[model samples]
Target chain A: MKAVAVLPGKPNSVHLREIPQPKLNDQPHAHVCSIPEGRAVLVKTLQIGVDATDREINEALYGNAPPGGEHLVIGHESFGEVLEVGAKVTELKPGDLVSCTVRRPGGSIYDKIGRNDITSEETYYERGINLCHGYMTEMFVDDAEYMVKVPPQLRHLGVLSEPASVCAKAIDQAYLAQHRLQVWSPKRAFVLGAGQIGLLATMMLKLRGLDVYTLATKPGPHRKSEIATAYGATYVSTKQESMHDLAKRVGKP
Target chain B: MKAVAVLPGKPNSVHLREIPQPKLNDQPHAHVCSIPEGRAVLVKTLQIGVDATDREINEALYGNAPPGGEHLVIGHESFGEVLEVGAKVTELKPGDLVSCTVRRPGGSIYDKIGRNDITSEETYYERGINLCHGYMTEMFVDDAEYMVKVPPQLRHLGVLSEPASVCAKAIDQAYLAQHRLQVWSPKRAFVLGAGQIGLLATMMLKLRGLDVYTLATKPGPHRKSEIATAYGATYVSTKQESMHDLAKRVGKP
Candidate 1:
C-alpha cells in the first residue's frame, strides 16, 4: 500500500511510499470499534482530502502535538469501502463505505482538530496524524467502532464525512453543552475561517438555524464573501473588521 | 459593589474592593449582546465557589502579582439573583434566579462546551475568568441570555445555577453532539474525572440516558463515587485502572 507519511520538521518531507498493505482483523461493530485490541481496517483510499491539520503539522506550530519526529501520514480525512474485517469483526463487511471519527474515544473533537492541526498522540493513533496509517494508504485498518457507515444519501459526500462529521459533531456537542445552561439555542454565529472545516462548520451552523458569518483571513470586496454566502454564510471580512466587531455587527438585534 | 479580586496570584493578597455597578446604556439590541446574552444573568452573588485554577495560581509558581495587582475575583461557579437590567432585558427579571454560561460568546452553545476548556477571547468573557470581574463580588452584571431558569423539578439539590449548569450543559451537549452526528444518542458513556466538572458531567450524562462510570483519582469509597452512583454512574477507581483502559472499556459495545 502506498501512503503519505510525514517525516516531521524537515519541511516538504512528506513521502508517498509503499508500506506492506494493512490487513483487516475481526472486530464486530458496524457502529464503532473500541480503539485497541479488537480490530484494524484496510481502506483502499478513494479520495482522501487534504486537511488543515495536515498543513499545520507539515508547516506551522499549532500546539497540542507530540515532538514531531515520527513518520506522519498527512490525510486523516478519508472514505472508502471496508475491504476486510478483523476475525473478531461481526459488523462491517467487505465493500461497506465508512469514515473515521475525528474523535478517538475519550477525547474532545475540538482538541482533535487542534491536534489534527499539529500532531498529537490520541489524534495520531486514531489515524493519519498518528502511528495508525491514514487512509492515504491503499488500505487502512481502524478500530471497528470508530468507523461508522456513511449513509447512502451522503455517499457523494461520504469521503467528506470524516471532516464534515467533525464539524457536525463539534457543533452538535457545542449545542448540547449550551442547552444545559440555557433553554434556548444560538441563532447566530461567527465562523473565523473560510477553509474546508470552516465551510463545513458554516454549513452545519446554518442547518441548525444560525445566521452564519464566515470571516475570512484574507478578504476581497467580494471573493470569499461570495463563496461563504453561497455556502449559507453571510460574509464578514476580517480585513474590514475583527471577528468580534463583525459578530457584534451581525449579532446585534 | 464589593468583590474579591485575585490580585496577581497570592491568594492571601486577594483584594476585597468596590467598583461601580455595571450599567447598560447601549440600545436594547446593541451589538454587544447576543440572544443567549439574555440568558446571561446579572447576579448579586451570596456565595462564590473557589475553583482549582485559583488554587494553582495563588499557591503555585505564578509569582506574586503586582502591588495594585491584576486582580481576578476567584469565583466562577456561583448563584445569584437578578438585581437590575437594561431596557432590553426581558427573558429574566430583576428578581428571577439565574446562572452563567461557562463560556463567553460568539460561538454556539455547543461550540462553547466543546471549546469551553480552551480559552478564546470570543468564546469566553464577561463576569468570570479573566476578561471581566468574576462573581466573587458584591454584584456583577452578565449577559442575561446565558442564564437558565432553575427547574423546580431538581429543587432538592440547592446548588446554584452556575455549578449545576456546568454539569447539566456538559451532559446535554454530549448528547446533542451525538444526536447531530447520525441520530443515535449515547445510552452509555464514561466520565474521566469525578471532580467538580466530572461530577456534573456525570449527572448530566446519566440524565441523558448514559450509564456513566466515574474514574475517581483516588479509589476506595468516597463522597464523589456516592454522588456519581446516586446520579446513576458505575464507579471505576483511577488507582486501579487507567483512563485509557476505561475509555476502551466504554468504547466496547
Candidate 2:
C-alpha cells in the first residue's frame, strides 16, 4: 500500500512511499492489524482531513515515528469504511462508514476510564501526530471501540467528526462550569477565530439558541464570514474593533 | 471594615486598612452590594482559605485592584453566612452557609450561558484575584446566583470548596472526553503533586472508585502523604523512582 509519510527529524521531507499492508490479528493490542478476536474492525480509508497538526509534523515541530521505523504515516482526521469485522463485533458490519479517533489510549488510569485525551502521564500517542500510523493510507484497522459510526445520511460530513469532537469537548466543559448557577441560561457566545474550530463551535452554539458572534482578522464578505452568517452567527473583523472594546459593547448577559 | 489588601506593583506590600462597607442596590450588575430587587444576598464572611493564588497576588506576580481602587482585596476562597436576601432570591435565605464562586461573568456570550469560567473574552473577573473585591472583608454582597449552598454537615469543609471546585472542573473535562467510549471507566488516577490542587484531585478521584496515586518530592509518612493514605490514595516519593520508570511499571490501564 502507498502511504504519505514524513521522515523523523527531517523537516519538510514528506513523501509517498510503498509500505507493507497490515495483517489480521487476534490480539486486541495489535496496532497495524485487524483484531480477529471480534472487537476490532478492518477499515478501508475513504477520506482524510489535513489540518495544522500535519503541517507542524512536516516542519519537525513535533511528531514521532514509530519505534525503529524511520518514517511515520501522516494523517489523523479520517473517515473510512469498515471492510471486515472481528468475530465478536456486533455493532458494525462491513461497508459501514466510520470515523476513527486520533488519540490512542496510554498506560494510564485515564485510558482505563476511556479518557485517553486527558491521560495524565503525558505519554499518550496521537495518530499521525506522534508515534503511530494514521489513516492516510488505503486501509487501516482499529478497535471498534475507538471508531464513531457515521450515519449514512451524513457520511459525506464524516471527515468533520474529529474537529466537531473538539468543539463538543469545549462546550461540555463550559456547561459543567455553568452548572454552578441555578437559573443558568447562556444567551450569547463569542468565538475568537473563524477557522474550522471556531466556525464549528459557532455552529454548535447557534444550534443551542445562543446569539453567536465570531471574530476574525479577515475582512467582511469573505467566505469564512459568509459561512458564519450562514450559520446565523454575526462575524466581526478584529482589525476594526479590539476584543476589549467589543466585549464592553456587548455588555454582560 | 478592616480588610487585607495588596498594593499592585509592590510585591509583598500587603497591609490592613479600613475600607468603606458595601451597600444594597437594585441593579443586578452591582458588584459589592445585594440586589434590592429580591434577587441577591448579603453575606457575612465566616471563613477564608489562603492558598497559592493569594501568595502570588501578594508577590505582585498577578492580580488587579478594582477600578478606581489602589489596593486589591486578597481572598477568593471563602465560606460565609447569608445575612440578608433580596425579594426575588428564593434559593437562599438568612443564616444559610454558602461558598461563593470565584469568577464573575463577563460581558460575553459565555457569561450568558453560565460559563464565565471559560469565558472567551479576557474581561472576566475573579473575586479578589482581579478587578473585584475579594471575600477577605467582614461582609459582602453578591447575586444569589453565584453562591453554592454549603450543607450544614459540610460547613466545616466549606473553605475547601473553591479548591475542590478546580478538581471538579478537571474531572468533569476528563469524563467528558472519556464519553467518546461506549463503556468508559476510569480505574486509577495519578496526581502529579501533593499541593492543595493535587491533593483535592486525588481525593475526588479516589471517591470515584479509582485507585489514586499522588507523587511528591517529600519523604513518606509526612502529613501530605498521610492525608493521601487517609483518602485511600497511595503516595509515591518521586525522589526514589523516576517518573518514566514508574509509568512503565504501572503500564497502560
Candidate 3:
C-alpha cells in the first residue's frame, strides 16, 4: 500500500511510500503484522482532512514518528469504512461508515477511564500527530474503542466529524466554565477568528440562540464573512476597527 | 464612627476616618442617607479580616471610592451581626450572624443573574475593593441578597467565610475544568504557594482524600509547614529542590 508520510524532523519530506497492508493485530504498525485479534478493526480509508497541525508537522515544527520508525503518517481528521471487524467487535461490522478518534491513550490515569484526550501526562499520543500513526493511508487497523460509527446517510459529511468534535468539545467547555454562574443566559457570543474552526463555532453558537459576532483580521464582504452573515452573525473586520472599539459598539458577549 | 479608609490612588494614605452611621437605603454611599427600602439589612460590624487585597489597595495598586467620594473604605472580608432588617426582609432578622458577599451586581447579564463575581464588563463593582464602600466600619447596610447568614455557633469562624469562599470557588472551578475527563480521580495534589489561601486549599484537598504536596520557598519545620503536615500534606521547600526535581522524585500530581 502507498501512503503519504513525512520523515519526522525533516521539513518538506512528505512523500508516498509503500507499506504492508494492515492486519487485525497489526494495530500500532502496519509492517509489524501479527495474527488477527478480537475487538480489532480493519478500516478502508475514505477521506482525511488536512489541517494546520498537518502543515506544521510537514514544516518540521513538531511531530514524532512511531518508535523505531523513520516516517510519520500525517492525517488525523479521518472518515473511513469498516472493511473487517474482529469477532468480538459487536458495535461495528463490515461496510459500516466510521471515523476514528485522533488521540490514543497514554499511561496516565485519565487514559485508563476513556478520557485520554485530557491526559495529564507530559508525554501523550495522538494518531497522526505525536508518536503515533495517523489515518492518511489506504487502510489501517485499530481497536474498536477508537472508531465511531457514522450512519450511511451522513457518509459525505463524516469527514467533518473530527473537526466537528473539536468544535463540540469547545462548546461543551464553555458551558462547563459558565456553570459557575447561578444562571447564565448569554444573549451574545464573540468569536475572535474567521478560520474553519471559528466559522464552525459561530454556526454552533448561532444555533444555540446567541447573537453571534465573528471578528477577523481580514476586511470582508468576502466569502467567509458572507457565510458568517448568512448565519445571522455580524462579521467585524478587526483590521478596520480595533476590537476595543468594536466591543464598545456591539456590547459585551 | 471610626473606620479604616484610603485615599484612592494615594500610596500609604490609610487612616482612621469618621463616617455617619449606616441606615437602610444608605447603601452605595455612607453620607447619602435615604429612606429605608425593602429587603435591606443593617449589620453591626463584628470582625474584619485584612488580607493582601487591603495591602494592595493601601499601596494604591487598585481600588475605587464611591462616586463623588475621596476615601475608599478598605475591607471586604467581614463578619457582622444583623442589627436591623427591612420591612420585607424575610430570610434574615435582627441578632443573626452574617457575612456579606464581596462583589455586587453590575450591568452585565452575568451580574443580573446573581453571578456578579464573573461579570464580563470591563467596569465592575466590589464592596471595599472597587466603587462600593466596604465593611471595615462600625456598621453598614446592604440588601439581604448580599448577606449570608452565619449560624450563631459558627460566629467565631465567620470572618474566615470570605476567604474560605474564595478557596471553595477555586475548587469548584477545578472540578468544572476536569469534568472534560470521563473520570478524574487525582491521587496527588500539588499546591504551589503556602499563603493563607494556599494553606486553606491544601487542607481542603487533604480532606478530600488526596495526597497533597504544599510547596513554598521557606524551609520546613516552621508554623506553615507544621499546619500543612498536621493536615497530612507533605511540605516541600522549593528553595531546597527545584520543582522539576521534586516532581521527578515524588510523582505526577
Candidate 4:
C-alpha cells in the first residue's frame, strides 16, 4: 500500500513508501488489531487533512514511529469510507462515511475510562503522531470503537471531524471546568487566533449563541476575517489594537 | 478592638493593633457590612488557626490591605461562637458554633454562583488575605450566607473546619473533573507533601476509601509520618528514593 512515511525527529524525512496493508488479524498489539474479530471495521481512505502537526513532525519538532519500526505513517485528521466490517460489527457497514479517533488509550486511569485524550502517562500515543501509524494510506483496519460514523449528507465536511473534535473537546472541557459555576451562561468569547481551528471554534461558539471575537496578527479585511464576520463574530487584528486595550474597551470575555 | 494586623508586603509587619470594632450596620462595602440587617450574624472569635498563608503574608510574599487601609487584619481560619443573629437569620443563631467561608464573591460568573473560591477575576477577595479584614479579632459581623454552622459536638475541632473545607473543596473539584470518566472509582492516591494541608487531604482521601501514599522530604518515624500512618496511609520519604523509583515500586497512584 502507498503511504506517506517520515523518520520522526529527522528534518525533511517525509517521503512516499510502500507499507504493509493493515488487516484485522490477531496481533500482540490490541491497539493494532480488531479484537474478537466481530468488532473490526476496515476503512478505505477518501480524504486526509494535512495540518501543522504533520509539518512539525517532518520538521523534526516532535513525533515518533511505532516501536520496532523505522518510519511513521503520518495522518491523524481523516475522513474515510467503510469498505468492510467483521461479522459482529453492527454500528457500521460498507459505503458508510467515517472518521477515526487519534489517541489510543495508555495505562492511565483516564485512559481506562475512554478518555485516552487526557492520559496521565509520561508518554502518549496518537496514531501517525506517536507510537502508531495514522490513516494516511489507502486503507486501515481498527476496532469499531475508534471509528465514528459521519452522515453521508455531510461527507464533504467529514475530514473536519478530527480537527473539529479538538475544538469541541476544548469547549467541552471549559464547560466541565465551569461545573463549579453551577449555572454558567457565558455571553461572550475571545478566540486568540484566526486559523482553521480558531475559525471552527468561532463557528461552534456562535452556534451556542455567544458573541465571538476572533483575533489575529494582521489587520485583516481578508478571507479569514470575512469567514469570521460571516459567522457573526467580530474579527480583531492585534496589530491594529492590543488585546489589553480591547479587553478594557469591551470588558472581559 | 485588638486584632492581629499586617502592613501587607512589608516584612515582619504583623502586630497587635487597635481597630474599629465591627457592627451590623450599613457600610459602603457590601462585604464589610451585613446588608438589610436581618441576615447578619455577629460571631465572637473562639479560636483561629494560623497557617502558611499568614506566615507568608507576614514575610511579605503576597497579600494586600483593604482599599484606604494601611493594615490588613489577618486570619482566614477560625471557629467562632455566634453572639447574635439578624432578625431574619434562619440558618444560625446565638450560641451556635460556626466557621466563615474564606473567599468572597467578586464580579466573575464563578463568584456569582457561591463559588467565589474559584473566581476568575484578576483580583480575588479572601477575608484576611487580600482586600478584606480577616477574623483575627475579638468579633466580627457578616451575612448569614457566609457562616456555616458547626455541630455543637464538633466544637473542639471547629477551627479545623475552614482548613477541612479546603480539602473537601479540592476533592470535590477532583470528582467534578472526573465527570467525563462517568464511573471513575479511584482505588489509590498519591499526595505529595506532608504539610498541614497535605495531611488534611490525606485524611479526606482516606475517608473516601482510597489507599493513599503521603510523600514528604523527611525520613519516617516523625510526628507527621506517625499521624499519616494513624490514618492508614503509607508514608514515603522522597529523600530515601526518587518518585520514579517509588512509582515503579508501588505502581501509579
Q: At residue A9, what lDDT does model 4 achieve?
A: 71
- Tens digits of per-residue lDDT for model 2, A163-239: 99999888876776555443457788999999889999999999999999899997799999999999999999999
* Displacement of the residue A98 alpha carbon in candidate 3, Å: 3.6
lDDT of 4 at A145: 88
Best by TM-score: 3
Candidate 1 per-residue lDDT over residues B7-114, each given as its tens digit? 653546666777666544322123323434334345676556666766654553333322243665656666666777656677777776655554454355434554
CA deviation > 4 Å runs, candidate 3: A23-42, A81-97, A106-113, A143-145, A149-156, A221-223, A226-232, B9-11, B23-44, B80-98, B106-123, B142-156, B218-223
DockQ of each: 0.09, 0.08, 0.43, 0.32
Q: Give the winner by lDDT: 1 or 4.
A: 4
Evaluation by TM-score, superior candidate among 2 and 3 = 3
Q: Show model 2 residue runs off by greater than 4 Å.
A: A26-36, A181-183, B1-253
Candidate 4 backbone collisions, by pair = A128-A134
- Candidate 1 chain B: worst 10 consecutive residues by lDDT? B24-33
TM-score of 3: 0.82
lDDT of 4 by residue, A1-253 (tens): 9999899878999999997777765241455433566788888999999999999999989898888878999999988999889888999989999999998878777787777888777787888888888889989888788899999999989999999999998998888776655667789999989888999999999998999999999888999999999999999999999999899999865
TM-score of chain B for predicted candidate 3: 0.93
- The CAPRI class of candidate 1 is incorrect
Residues A1-253 of candidate 1 have per-residue lDDT tens digits of: 6777766655666677776765465322222224355466655666788866777767633212223336655577887887777666677787888886544432444334433322322432445564444567776667775677877677788877777877876776667654434345456787878777888888888888778878786766565567678876787777778866765666543
Which candidate should be chosen as best, given DockQ against the real structure?
3
Docking class of 3: acceptable
- Give each model's clash number: 50, 13, 1, 1
